[model samples]
Target: MRWSHAALNCGDLDTTEKFYTTWFGARRVNEFDLGDLRIVFLRLGDAYLELFGQARPPAGETPGGDGHPVAGTVRHIAFQTDDLDGFLRRIEGQAEITLGPLDFSAHIHGWRSVWLRDPDGVIVEVSEGYRDRA
Candidate 1:
């Protein structure tokens, strides 16, 4: 099967929407307001992120981390990029880059990754040259 989308709770829709759109080239495809909850769909190429507005960061989560993956809870989402350097340049001063531009060529051939925190402190990973080893 193929990937479709990931749903996340954001502190603010505007900031969350802007972050994905600007840094990841996502565009808003649909939105909804169900009285107390607000939602937005951001299409990034074939996959999209479903954002639910007004969520607070959990106390246990670090600003940029996997946050103790236990059971079925969602930890983070990773994206594959074509130009790692160019993507880094785009996020330079605009976003809070948590870590990397680290290489993992030894383990995964040409794999490399960088982490960034979303408005809600979700650690999102953007990488290039990642491949499955068989």
Candidate 2:
């Protein structure tokens, strides 16, 4: 079966929506108010991300941490791009670049990637030449 969509529990829907749209070119396709929870669906090319927000504010810390994954962790959300350099330039000063725009050619043939953190500190990876590597 093919992949459908991924969901994220966001603290602020507007901020999260702007982040994805501004950097990754995601467009809001639909939204719903489900009594206790509110959700917005964003379409990025063929894929989708559902952003969920609760009526009550978050009680404690978010699910993931900065470095090193614990068991059963869903490390990061990755996106592929044709022009990595141009995308990097577009996002300058918009968010923090947490990790490399480094080369992965040694391990993955022609692959190169970079990592950035969203407003809520969720890791987002952007890569190029993944099809060749795959």
Candidate 3:
């Protein structure tokens, strides 16, 4: 089976949608409003990312805190790019680079990766040269 979309809880739907669209070239595919919550789906090629926003978040749960550095149910989300250098250049001063543009040549062939945080502190990993052994 192929992979599908990943969903995220966003504090601000507009900001989160803009972030994905501007940096990853994602386009809006669908949206839903359910009185107290809003959902938006964005497409990047076949893959999709879902954004969920709530008007009133449940107690003890902080909105837009999904990308915390600490370990949790989901630590981070990753994306692969063909032009790593160009992508980095595009995001300059726009997004926060939390970790490397490090080489993983020895461990994983020619893979190179960098990590960053989204608007809500969610860690995102971008890499290149990953060989899918499917």
Tens-digit lDDT string for candidate 3 (34-73) = 9888999999988999999853443453223224444565
Which 10-residue window in model 2 sums to the lowest lDDT?
A: 59-68
TM-score of 1: 0.87
Best by TM-score: 1
lDDT of each: 0.84, 0.81, 0.82
Residue 2 lDDT in candidate 3: 85
Q: Compute each candidate's TM-score over C-alphas.
A: 0.87, 0.85, 0.83
Per-residue lDDT of model 1, residues 35-87, tens digit only: 99999999988898999997776677465543336667666788899899999
Candidate 2 C-alpha lDDT tens digits along 1-134 = 77889987787888999999988889999999988888999999788999997534545554333333757756789999988999999998888887888887877767888888877667888999876423
- Stretches of model 3 off by over 4 angstroms after superposition: 55-72
Going through the candidates in order, what is the number of backbone clashes in each?
Answer: 0, 0, 1
Candidate 3 global CA lDDT score: 0.82
Per-residue error (Å), model 2, residue 96: 0.8
